[model samples]
Target: MKEQSRRLGEDSIGSLMARLSIPAFIGMFVMGMYNIVDTIFVSYGVGPNGVAALSIAFPVQMILMAMAAMFGIGGASIISRSLGAGEQKTANTVFHQVIWLVIFSSLLIAILTFIFIDPLITMFGAPAEIHQMTKEFLEIILLGAVFQSFGMGMNNIVRSEGNAKTAMLTMIISAVINMILNPIFIMGLDMGVRGSALATLIAQAIGAAWLLFYFLSGKSTLSLKGFGLRIDVKLGLRIIAIGFPSFIMMASGSVVTIAVNWMLQIYGGTMAIAAFGVANRIASFAIMPINGVTQGMQPIVGFNYGSKQFGRVSHSVKLGMLVATILSLIAFAVAEIFPAELARIFSSDPVLIAESEEALRIMLLAAPTIGFQIVCGGLYQALGKARISFIISLMRQIICLVPLLLILPNFFGLSGVWYAFPIADFLAFSVCVVILSTTWRKVFRETEMVR
Candidate 1:
């Protein structure tokens, strides 16, 4: 374990990326597949309204994930850097604190979600027609929210300790279990949308259990011992500060989804919302591999940066960005070529098929540029530049996308809604290039002077 973990600071960039990224990609692919599977089973079993209900429930779920990211991504950065600096005790402390934080924060979120279940769903743009179904789905989902949050948070820590395959297994096992159970619960048992939520809960619980066991068994570099549940105020604050950008990045997704849902409700009604849901799922699937690439790069970048190996850090980021861009281009091709066919897989409804086809194409038009934007944000996060990372993340979703969503729709209606994504993608892409180039140049100069 010590040797494997040490290689994060020693391995060649290409070799480390290959070793780390492939598993992360598979794990992320499975993560993305969960939604695709749910949409397929739920649409066939419970119909289009069921699809809309899941759509309305998505933003709330994103918020839950945001909470996880805040702890997981935040703490992992600390853990990786600590390991790089040869401070195993500090890394252990961060791990234990992360677990405690995830547990507490998730429980709090679950309670609040349950308390405002009705209002929250309504606020998420659940149309009157599908409001009841949306509530039912969200209710069951919230019950298992803690498991989802904890499992996701722990997975990042596992990877940071240089156990990428283990982290990948956590997601794979959960997704496979969810896929198998979803059909049985939703169709055979006649549980409908609630069944889908239940399946997710059970799967997440299993994944969480596996992670907790791994850390507790003395198998990890950072174990679940030597630190009490009570968090150190100073350390806890640092974790939150570093992770806050991830929280906002994910929360911004929730905000964007809600805004889009409301506009769809106003302009195109429930069917439009359903179509957007299909597009969203496909888009998420496309992005997940790119996300996995950045994730693979995170430990590498954080460790190298901490060890002050600026050259290695630079190499890793550029390679990751190139791989991510290639993946995004492939996704773009799939979106453009098979838009209608992909939509039809989710629903047999003709109108939804047509609507989703168009939306999918427009939304992914600038996907070729999206990889650079995301990679840059991930690089910032790895370098512990949370404020810059937060800005880049916010710009893509809130700063650029939201205002354009509002104005463009006023002029072009539904078409304008479709156009907003590519416009934001281009704008965010430009910003990322400027920021990355300027920062990297400074780092290179500093390293030269030090030499």
Candidate 2:
């Protein structure tokens, strides 16, 4: 067995988690920071409209990311398990398949996006004032879709092999490049929102190049030399099946965003959408550490479960949930205490800041429950239980939130839109508790049998 794979099955859960998660936490946090920084620069450079344009353009970006997540995440699950089971060949094959799949899918999406840029932007609920800017920003961003997809997809593969530091370095490098370039392009060059898009494109391209080098230089546990690049139909199908839940989660998020944007348009106009855009960014940033924990937990759970180390699997899950809850509580406190201060980081406009503060506090009202819900969904995914994971993924956005979003505004006005978030979060948390409790014993009973 390779050293990395063995470490995953043997390492102390607490120390291993810290080793893996801390890098992922730092990387995801910095990666998220660039987005925040991008917004800050745009908010200052071109004003509230620029920030609103980003919000409108965000759903389409989510669609592109959904494709990457589907392949990356799905492939990572297989690779980690295959490694644990001593199937190196299978891991290499999946890696190559992910590469080809990401390239093909991203290119296809980008071309289609370019062709339908105008109507697509409008469909995302872009108001008249920001529609043109949204279109321009998206156009430049699409130019680098393949780069973004490659980097995102391969980063998962790197982590699956237990090279968390490499994965971390990839994001850190990209984010640093992006932050340095954002001000120069947006303010110095006077390029506005388009410049923000351009800087992101360059950073993604560099990140992709770094991953490509890592694989080609024989640094990865999965080698490229002996593997045929042909896609195995059955294996590819499995990858898609496993990853479909992640795809659904993200794609549904895009749908939810579009729905929310339309609702905001109806009730609160352009400024409300801008506020949502900012507040959403802040919320996403706060949740990054939880995401990092889940990412760290995935490989450990997959490896141990594959090797039938059920005790470690249970331990990892419990520890992950505990840590995630702590992080979420911190986020909740921060959002409650300093909504306006957080809002001010993006824009100085009194109206926009005030709107953002209200939205942030309201939307994150169930913040304490968020970590549990997120980790539960991720746990199922790591276990390769796609069906259960898919159901869990659906509960928050499609089942609970969407219905609330559609029904609430009629009775409560714009505030209804904000209320939908926390309500869904709490409901999802309730369901997760029930599911985890019912299934917990059955999942680990086999461990007792083995003993």
Candidate 3:
């Protein structure tokens, strides 16, 4: 056996979760730091123009995540299964194929975006005047697509190999660089939105390089030594199938952005859209930490499910939900009490601040409930029940959430729009509970892991 593999069943459940969750949580927060930092700067730097451009550009960025999640979630799912079964070699082979796939897919996304960037931004509702600024930011950030894909995809493998510490460090490294460069290029060098894009591109490239080094140097606990040099259709398909839920979930992010932007423009004009942007930025910032907690749970859930340690699987799922709920509630309180204060952090306009605060408070009140919906959904994913997970995410995001975001705002004006969040969460949680219960009984309860 390669030396980095975990000793056969050596750690206690508390020990293992403690070891993993700390780093995973930290990494998730760090992972989002630069994005949030630049977002704050852009919102204030060029006033509403920069923030709106960023809002328009944000969906494109999300698509990149969807692509990464496609392979990352897929590859990591299989890798965790392999590890639980004590098959490092199989895990290695899968990792190799996934890396090469990342490179190819990322390059393809970049080229397509470059060719179609303008029309896409316009399609998202960018006005004729802000078109040039939006295009510039998109062009610059799009250059980093390959690196973002590589780094994001590989980070999942790093964690799956039980090197959650290393994965966390990798994100911290990239985030620090992004933070340092963002101010220098944007303010010191006066690059504006272009600067933000350049800084991000360079930082992601460094992260991708770090991931490459970890595997090639024979230091990764799980190595892709002799596998995935070339793509295998069968292997790739399995990865995608498991990952498809994440893709749909993330793709739904785009859908929400479109609907919200179009509604905000009609009901409240640019101020409303900008206010929506503020709420999203703060919400995403808070959710980043919640996502970390869920990520920590994924492998634990996966390993236990694969080992048929049903009780451990159940415990971890519950723990994840508890943590997510608690954190989200705290965030909701902060946003609700000081919505204007939160908005002031991004911009100084009183009108924007007031509108944003109401939107932020309304958006966040139901956010704590998101913890249950996500972790419950993730429990299904960790068990490789992608279809169930996908349905919950689809209905939550598309079926219930989108409709609320559109219809609610019309009746209550801006406040109605903001209140759409918790309403959707309330509905989605019930749906998620049904899926969780069914999958738990049908899959985990009835099946036994094959030795």
List ranges where model 3 is wrong by over 4 Å.
Answer: 1-9, 227-229, 449-451
What is the C-alpha lDDT profile of model 3 across 249-276, one tens digit per residue? 8889988887777777668777777778
**TM-scores for candidates 1 onward, in order:** 0.98, 0.98, 0.95
Worst 10 residues of 2 by lDDT: 442-451
Candidate 2: regions farther than 4 A off: 227-229, 445-451
User: Tens digit of lDDT per residue, candidate 2, span 1-451?
Assistant: 5687679998899988998899999999999898899999999999999999999999989988999999999999999888888888888889989988899999999999999999998999999999999988999999999999999899988989888998999999999999999999999999999899999999999999999999899778988875565867888888888888888888899999999999999999999999999999999999999999999999998888878888888889999999999999999999999999999999889999999999999998899998888888888887888887888889998999999999999999999999999999999899999988887676567456332
Model 1 gets an lDDT of 0.90
Clashes per prediction? Answer: 0, 0, 1
Ranked candidates (lDDT, high to low): 2, 1, 3
Report the lDDT tens digits of candidate 1 across residue range 1-451: 3876899988899999988889999999998999899899998999888988999999889988998999899999999999998998889889888988998988998899889888888899888889999988888888888899999899999888778998999999999999999999999999999999999999999999998888778778887666676778898889988888899989999999998998888888898898998999999999999999999999999998878888788889889999999999999999999999999899988999999999999999999998898889888888888888888888889999999988888989998888999999999999988887677676557556322
Q: Choose 1 or 2, whichever is better by lDDT.
A: 2
